[model samples]
Target: MKQPNIILIMTDQLRGDCLGYAGHPDVKTPYLDTLASKGVCFDRAYSACPSCIAARAALHTGMEQSHHGRLGYEDNVPWNYANTMAGELSKAGYYTQCVGKMHVHPLRNYLGFHNVDLHDGYLHAARYGSVPYRESQFVADDYFYWLKQELGVTADVTDTGIDCNSYLARPWMHEEKYHPTNWVTDRSLDFLRRRDPNRPFFLMASYLRPHPPFDAPQYYFDLYKDKPLREPFVGSWETEEYLRKDGRIFDSKTGPIDKELARQAMIGYYACITHLDHQIGRLIMALIEQEVYDDSVILFTSDHGEELCDHHMFRKSRPYEGSCHIPFLIAAGKNVLPDLKSSSTCHAVVELRDVMPTLLSIAGAQIPDSVDGSCLLPLTADPSASVRPWLHGEHSYGEFSNHWIVTETDKYIWHSATGQEQYFDLKEDPHELCDRIDDPDRQNRIHELRGHLIDCLKDRTEGMSDGSRLIPGRPYPVTLPHATAR
Candidate 1:
């Protein structure tokens, strides 16, 4: 069996339904659509812990959120896991390299990558003196440093006057070539020229766009500036829309009150997706030029999804579909066609943790027993193969802290602080605009789901549930002792 080269391309805060292949009404992602047509698309993929740090813990370690020990976003925590995706691949004689946003603690813990040309774009936690001076966070990121070296020290993301964590939209301050998206693509393609060809390579091209600041290059912004965007999903129980009537535009977690500003923000966000798609096209062409296009296995996904004002929520760390659901596709090149599926859709619930084992299986490497994710190869061979009966997801976002369990046909969510419950019939109400918890017809279904949720958490140290019932008003800590304390 030929050892296949692997390319894992990840985007930050990209929603699952925003892609053209996903039937999005306005977003133009032609390159991604083409890739999906030639690959297997996991239509119901999710992030277990819908935050940058915690979601990545599941991705790198191939463990569930409970086992990985990060239940929410916590900065400056060390990433000292014994086994990692890159480390295992490297041990199997693969050259591992990473480019762009790795939200790992200590700023520059290589995790398992042999070489990392990092470009973590505009991390507010690392920029505000939160990390010590000895750490890499105190210094400028590689992309920012390179931008300054090319255009002088005055060059910065602040030049656009857009806040990194806001709904404010703008074009890049400089040329499109200097944009971080292009930088990631550029450095990633450069690796193709520098990699040791004697060994199979594992390259991670991680792009930090479609997240916030909504900064796309001017040409990309123009692509969606005049298009009509689909409105965000609003539930009957949602109250934040009218409550957030006014606030500072740059730093507001609540999106703009004005309809026009919200529309523009959507335009900027779509532009960023299309811009990223074009760079992906460039990457594909480079792979062809290097003559490795037909011998590689390429997977594309996002860490988590953005709310974009859905239910009046703007950022991540929520249990909603717009925050936890993400896009996942696996495209096998021509040389590996016999071992992988093409132009197929898998209905099973897949998550970030599955990527490590799937790639390891493709590489003919050993999969550790501690991995919580199952190899997706069986599903590729038989789309109806059973993977998981249900997927559980949660995150801590102050009062919005929630835990949820999703099956193929329905979803159940519980708010830890308020003891509130929401049930959605996914098959009938995919948008989740109508909460069905209080529906008299669903009392039995709700009871069954609650029992499942309790069973899942009954053994945990958080004391979320006893064997008989759920314990309300008790929220689990964001970071467990196994995560960073111990």
Candidate 2:
């Protein structure tokens, strides 16, 4: 019984329904759809947190944000932190490697993994959608510096947002020669081509697109120029959308996002997603070309999802379905094709944290007891795996005390700064239009979710063995690497 290799493909801020397989009307995610047809499609795959750093930390640590405490994109991973799956797998002698946008900290290879390939960094430069005035960087020279040093692919690398008018006038929506996604995939292919297939390996190829700047390559834009973009009836820039930004909206807040501009933006975003899907296709092709596709297992998902104006919110970092519910697809080796690929969907409200343990289990590596996420093997085997009755997520950074709890039917959110509590019955309001928090009939559900939320906080705090952390006023060191500047 030889151990199988694992390839994890992460696309930043991808939504579930945005793919053709997921019933996307206009967006053509053909490769992803094909991948879904061969494996399990977790229709309701959930993220522990919507923010980039906190969500990834929770995912990798198999712990909730409340437990791991690396709350923002800037907090560095603690040196003494629990050994991650990468660390444990490396201990078991797997050839573990990572490429692309590494948003987590302790940026060096502390996961006990071998060969840390820091290809692209995630921060302001990679942020898409509407980059707020405060955090937007028009120049990305730092990213280019590393690209030239390593891949020799060069671009102006300057933050383009500095002169929006001038930047838009440049003709190309994205840098033609060296888009970040292209660069990441380029290096990843290079690494894959020189693979030692005899040994078991874990390869993480992460991409930071469809995440922000809402910028897509010119060709991708051309691919979706005529798509229709419709804003949700329940969303508005004045309220939920504006609030979600936390004052990050760079454009005027006079009214809702223009319908055509919204359409254009959606086209760009979907195009970027398609671009990413093609990259995965290339990697998968590489596997087939190398005759390793049948010998390996490949999983494609995202750290979290992006809210493309679903709640009128421009990006992810919110607990809406558009942001937290990502597409989870797994393609087992060519031999034992998964049964639930087509007619089945995992209803279990799972978290990204489950990834680490699940990968370890499948790889025949020793699963450590430190992670908070359980192995998702059962769910993968059978779509109706008894799902968690209730799930919790949190992200504490820069005055954002975002925490959420979702049960079989109810979704409750707690925002401390505004002293607001929101409740929605997902069963009835799939679009999340009606807020039933004030309804007397839903009081019991609210109370139940609140109790679960408290229990979750307490459990994570106790398990973490650290005092609760305070949200900061500004973004600081996210325990980032030198490649992030690129």
Give me the candidate number with maximum lDDT: 1
Please give, for residues 1-486, the per-residue lDDT of candidate 1 as tens digits: 778899999999999999999999898899899999888899889998998999999999999988889999887777778888998999888999999988888777888899888887777777765456645442636787788789996788767888777788989988889989999999999999888887899999999988877899899888888776788788897886343664347446566777777788789889999999999999988988999988998999999998887877677888888888999999978998575567788888999999999999888899987689989988877877758989888887677789999887889999887889999998898888999999999999989988888998899988889978888778678888787532
TM-score of each: 0.97, 0.82
Deviation from native of the Cα of residue 146 in model 1, angstroms: 1.1
Q: What is the Å distance of residue 362 in model 1 from its true position?
A: 0.8
> Best by TM-score, which number?
1
Score residue 422 of candidate 2 by CA lDDT. Answer: 85
State the lDDT of candidate 2 residue by residue for 388-456, as single tens digits.
Answer: 787876554334456788765669987644446788788887668878889999898787787776665
Candidate 1 achieves a global lDDT of 0.86
lDDT, each prediction:
0.86, 0.64
